[model samples]
Target: GRALGEDYEVRAAATAEEGLAAVEADPEAVDLVLLDIRMPGRDGFWLLDRLREGFPNLPVVMVTAYGDTETAIEAMKRGAYDYLVKPFDVAHVRALIEAARKQRALTRSAVSLEPDAPSPGDRIIGNSPAMVEVYKRIGQIAATTLPCLITGETGTGKELVARALVQYGPRAEKPFLVVDCAAIPKDLLESELFGYEEGAFTGARKGGKLGKFELAHGGTLFLDEIAEIPLALQSKLLRVLQDGTFQRVGGTEEIRADVRVIAATCADLEARVAAGAFRADLFYRINVGRIHLPPLRERRGDIPALVRYFVQKHGAAVGRPVTGVSEDLLRALQARPWPGNVRELENEIRRLLASTRGEVLAAEIPPACPGEDAACGELRSLAARALEEGGEGAFHRFVARAEASLIAEALERTGGNVSAAARLLGITRLTLRKKAEEYGIRVPDPDA
Candidate 1:
């Protein structure tokens, strides 16, 4: 109390009832609460439910004893701002408080889909016909608890679509959790989704932990890169989807959670299932409602609006607000084949915002290599010629010639500057130099 009292007002309550009384007497008296999980009379969770129901905006941080981290995690799932294990230092508490305050403010704001709204909310900005279909699909399903599968190439804003689904849904006020299947290690993925019991495994936290399904009760859980989940764990996921019941990693008691599952992936699940890499049953279960987002290249008409939206969004964040982008820049942007989709385009715009000095952005957009169709056609022609002339090693010879040609072209365009050339080619300077040397392509001095 002494440590925090020096920095904060520091209200004190001995028991859960007292804490409730403290808040009930005057809710405005407290901005945050530090509640312990093992309190007398009414437990922290019971009180937490009251706080969340009575004052949904109030941020609460769970204070748990050492070895009770899992319970703390469960409290977090129940809308606690954060948790702190006993024996934490003063610095940790302060840092958590600051973070929680910032996040609380951020979460309360609504997300907007308005194309040209002045507010800092329109995270999704597009009016293309394809995108209109996406919006329509979201509107149709967002109000239900149907399990949804979002499919799109990477950076096509799958997560944003998932967020839109949540924001427009009946569970808008509930917790929304995200798990990136590709990002987490395969061995750890199961535990992350379902959590584990204390002593479930060596080095596991003391108290049994609640998984996403349990934590996200009455909310939404988004699984990104859904195809990456291991084949072994697919059944457990399917069980939850079918019955809304799953057990913790080391515990046997079945836990049921009212969580809506929304999954996203860039990979083809049908192909994965055919290859025995994914479960067909699970695939069908989650694919009940599907939304496919088109790649940025396919939605070229939306490029100008996206560009303007990104400029405004990033400019304000970086304190380099621009008046507008030039028509020539928009034309150039629309012409490029953004292999990385919306994310890549936003990055290009951010780069321009950083480099441009004028209020109106008129910087020359770098020329793109080629549209997908044209590039594929060019490759087909090259391969046919190679097959006819190069005979036995046609594939290898064609690849070598293509690499050498691209490297030589990039070097020439960049005036033999290896780093600049490498950036243009989307490769490391060292790799470019090695390839250039192997191909006997002339490059100026490394420094020059």
Candidate 2:
């Protein structure tokens, strides 16, 4: 306090408890905290936890004798603005304090604007070009009221994207309702959607309940597995789309709803329409603004980012220190064809974190699918061929080389166990064995 002039006010406490008490007594007065790591009663890290829980916006700079990378990373994870080693320059400390203060102020301002605007949530985390484009499209679509149809394979985060759209959209202030069309019983779907008037059905409520459509007024209504919506109900839904009016069962009064419709489906609606099972008109209506989320295998570049995000998220949820994802583990993740997509990746990360005992992630990561290795070999062969040929002929060479490489790799991975390889490749075992013969790929014998 004596060293610094009136421009700064310094408070001294004998113990961590006293310091915490001083801050508790007057939180606003304390702009920055210079915490000593070896404080009595409670260490700086413990104090950091208290600050994080009570006042997350407050910045705490840890003071240590020697620099420790693990400790610094952990402290940063625990909300410490920065750390300062002992014998450090006074100017460095001043700079750190200023930077921390600026960061805190910025965080507070950002939090105040839209606390629930999906600010880098653990569900969708990536900064890759593909992911950036996805985010840009989401933001652009959020401004409009166009109906969106999200088509993706199971576990590709279709619903998460839908929620992002709703949360960031203009109608974010209103209710965002979700209806799992596939989960609801087909017989009761109409009542669930259009509501039944009093005495309209034997078990109808006395006051007549509000249907999901009316409940989602001035907001977004998300229909999951839209292809499951019964054919008969599809016509009623289409009417609601054409004109924002739906009539309650046994009631002549028409109810109008102002809501943005967003639908998701794993099934091919075109196929169902062709089969006369789904209404073509309804399909066309909901498919106005389509967003097809790429499967995880197609976006292998995002695996590392996703792994990091999940490790941090799950580690924090379980009160464990954030762990590092090893290069080998990342390579395994990249090689695997994530048929289940982001949801599958999240589950795998959670499992790894639960079984892991320390800070390294690779040790606990489970064995990867053998198919991944084969796929990687095929990709490498394709790259090699592409490099050998010039750019003009690279595309043709790569395609042929990839096909041959895949057939050879598949046969080799199965140990000439063509039947097993066939199943893995999603083809008949006989077809796989025949292809292996045609490609002249020497399949290894099981005995060898």
Candidate 3:
């Protein structure tokens, strides 16, 4: 009410089931939700899953403690619009609410006309600031025929973004051609891009095949590994960009080039130019609109969403039904450095889906284990969040989660030796066994 006064009236729900039922009864009545992560019986994360089921596009912001980055990321991965930390600033809250409201309105507008109206590019899953910036750029350049240069590390989704720009724009109905500059030999790169006349060379086709540029006329052409274009061919590409005209190899006629160009490079073009490998002039031409995709490590927050996406995509391929991933596997995934970026993460998820028959991915052993301090980190974060939301109010669930994690870790470290694990915990064997049972800790077989 403070933000929009009469226009916005908040209807509060004290519990998860209450909120779920209210939304289920009349989801249209609520424009947004501010859900606390540490509710009794069911936490904010639980409600997020339920809400997504009933209203996939409804904006639900997880209200977390100030430093619960893990929870915030998990919430977003579960399809929350954004998250708000405790001690919320009125201005920031208002801004998030307004943004979510607008986005929800837009989605509803589009979905009303066509139930499956989401464009391929709009489905680029991520909530990290870096991926958010990438999405913004995709929206900014989607409508125009601008020369866009996308720079990123290999497998960082440069080609995906280029396709999104075309998929979500006015040119979506037109042809989209892709040329891998590094894949083709330097000798054939020119002929491959601008085509050639019949009998232009010893092995030329009798009827002459059209180049990527001609085939992509009036649409968009993606040049992958753009920095690999040989110096001799750079001038020809520049001519096409400058005057929208290019001649077929060994032909006198100049063809009108009505294609929009999007170039991607994992290499450093400026450095390539300095080393006299890439043309500085051509670099500037394609740099009209630029997008730099961040490596996966920089945007680890997106791992959950990417995992969810890949699970949904590849699960049905092998006829498996995957509901979601386990917290252990998800945490382990986030711990990885992902040197190969999104591509590596995608492949890993695909592998898990193919290997596992269960609904949860944690059934498959994690690729990496999180640090020993992972529980401590979570404990401190939850404590701080609890204090901010309710001073001196002890959150038993937080303590329980920390205990469960510790017990599980100890059992794993002890090789299922009850006496050894009890000694390591400084507790009696019976207490250790009971705690392990309570936390559902499985002691792996030492021999097996």
Rank order (by TM-score, best first): 1, 3, 2
Q: Candidate 1 local accuracy as lDDT?
A: 0.77
Tell me the tens digit of each residue's lDDT in model 1 across 1-448. Answer: 8998888888889899899899999875576788888877888999999988877666788887855657866886787766778878998788666545433332333223233457545566676557655665675577678999999876788999899889777899999999987556678999999999999999899887778888899999999978767767889999999998999998899889899999998767775564344688999999999999998888898887787778767777557558788998888888887767787788788888888988888899877654566456446444543564533777776696578657766766676677898999999998997986665454566555
RMSD of each: 21.8, 19.3, 21.4
Indicate which candidate wins on lDDT. 1
TM-score of structure candidate 3: 0.58
Lowest lDDT block of 10, candidate 2: 110-119
Report lDDT (CA) for all predictions: 0.77, 0.71, 0.73
Better of 1 and 2 by TM-score: 1
lDDT of 3 by residue, 1-448 (tens): 4555555788778899998988888877888888888888898888998887767667788887755667767877887777777777887777666656655544443233221233332345666657655654665567578899999876688888888778666788999999977556678999999999999999999988789899998899999988667677898999999999999998999799799999998766775564344678999999999999988878898788777767766666768567778998888889876656777688788778778877777755454335534344335444543343343425754465456545555655665577877788788877876765554344434357
Candidate 2: residue 391 lDDT (0-100) = 46
lDDT of 2: 0.71
Separate clash counts for every candidate: 0, 0, 0
lDDT of 1 at 446: 53
